[model samples]
Target: MSWGVRSILHGLDFVLQNIAWKPGIDSDLNVWSTRWVDGGMPEPVDFLLEEGFGFMKDFRIKDLCYNGGGRNEGMVRLIFKQESVDKILPTPLISTRSHDEVFWPFSDEVRYTVKSGYGVIFGEFFNNKGTLKDKERLNLKKKRFCKTTLWKLPGPQLWKILLWKIITGSLPIGSEFIKRNLGWDPFCTLCGKELKEVETLEHLFRDCDVSSRIWFGSVLGIRTDQNTFLELGEWIINWITYLKGQKENYYGLTHFLVTLNSIWTLRNNSIFRGESFVQKVFFKQLGSLVSLAIKNPVMKITNDGEGVFNSNDSEDLEDELNCLKDALLVLVID
Candidate 1:
């Protein structure tokens, strides 16, 4: 085959592997073989083929839905595993009668694009080669935290990218430097010279005394030392998930991101500028950043096709700032 044709075919293979089917009337998609469910690659149901149910192998997704396009819960629960059922039921059918459409699940637009396709291919390349540690790679593929939580967060794009780097171990920290043989000291500089602990992502962010103090001193009142998760990625996922549940306005998440940014900045200053971690200065700067984030919150598109701020009104903003100030007041730094 010609090189051009061969390249096209190679790209097509990657496209097909990552694409998922969005059920409309669901008449065109085979339930057992099509990538109709979310999470990962689609596979046939794991049940043994029975005498009378051989015909089910050819069943389309529409067969499991009512004539009006609602899910046929009885047949779905009976035929598919509970895991499949859980994913299938929540998937909304098209309001009008239409054919099923193939979509790129990784992008917000749900349409195939060159950028997203390349991202999927690149991610898979590293994942297959075991470049990322096992638990981190598994969490990335399974949870899809970037698409689900990080991208949806209302903040500056830089802030989101920083969070992504931290989760993915893409930051140029001491451990990463050691891995690349850059001859930089890999020990936690924030923990001082006497302690001599290697600065892994977890230790720098969560386990170090300085970072732990920052977390504890924040308005969120998080105690990093009390974190139970073994993996830093998992630990962050837990807190982000909790923040999502607890706050409707996303103030908690915004504050959390700001605090993380401050901690990182503090670490950098300590390393590069020979600065010491001062509680008063750090908290003062953190409060200003938080206030700045509130005043200029991210803009989001509303259901009515209007762009609105993700922040509260002046009065509400004042109240929130006061609350944060009051909380910070209780945290005394010697």
Candidate 2:
């Protein structure tokens, strides 16, 4: 038994004690002896304990009410008062064929419910309120995002799904497709490099010239380099942890995630379609994507001590969001 149930029974032991089993075909209850009437004697028999009411040879307390009405009205009148008879007749009989059953008076239903039992114990104190903890309790001024918090980033389901795929290293990039024997070329879809490389998650999300341009669009004047592409998943974790602690980074990471999602989407579209992975298109798509996905009223717009976003800054923040999640996940696992 759970502590909730045990505590309930412990607190309401008296209620159980007062509950007497009604007689069935077997007639287990001694009607005169049982305490049924308002926790008092079942019947107000004038005779003492030495002199019983009478041998109830045929009828039983349980059989008294079989079909919503009492079969032994005369016998009931003989032992119990009009008030007692009234209470007994409409008691919603336990059984007709099987032996009599005992039930909690808290519920009219046959089975004891968890909600009823829970209510009996903790109804007054149970909290139905959500995870809305008081801010003063923790005194947390700024909401921070870390590796664990990344999974809970509330936005479009596709965004979260892609993120999960990225972290798992199962994203449908060219190299991943060929690894599964999907019979496809594993070359960069977004880059116009002379010598193409296998379009791995590392190449798609980072290292690609197109993606590098997106990062260059950030207002933070963020620069992408060799380190930015190494150990993608660990970098993400470090990226989040580092940014979370810095007031300077603030909500700047939002732009990063958006930029990553946009570049990936464009890369996917460019695989078969004629979608452009140009820096301008990336910035245009990102602004619209972030606005539609992140509709929360309290969301902050971070300015990285740079001028407001314009056409020139598009590449700075654009592909800066794209980073290798799956590659790092494999590295982390290895």
Best by TM-score: 1
lDDT of each: 0.66, 0.49
Best candidate, lDDT-wise?
A: 1
Q: lDDT value for candidate 1?
A: 0.66
Off by over 4 Å in 2: 1-147, 291-295, 298-334
lDDT score, candidate 1, position 226: 59
Model 1: residues with Cα > 4 Å off, grouped in runs: 1-137, 141-143, 297-334
Cand. 1 TM to true fold: 0.51
Q: Give the C-alpha lDDT of model 2.
A: 0.49
> Which 10-residue window of candidate 1 scores lowest in summed lDDT?
325-334
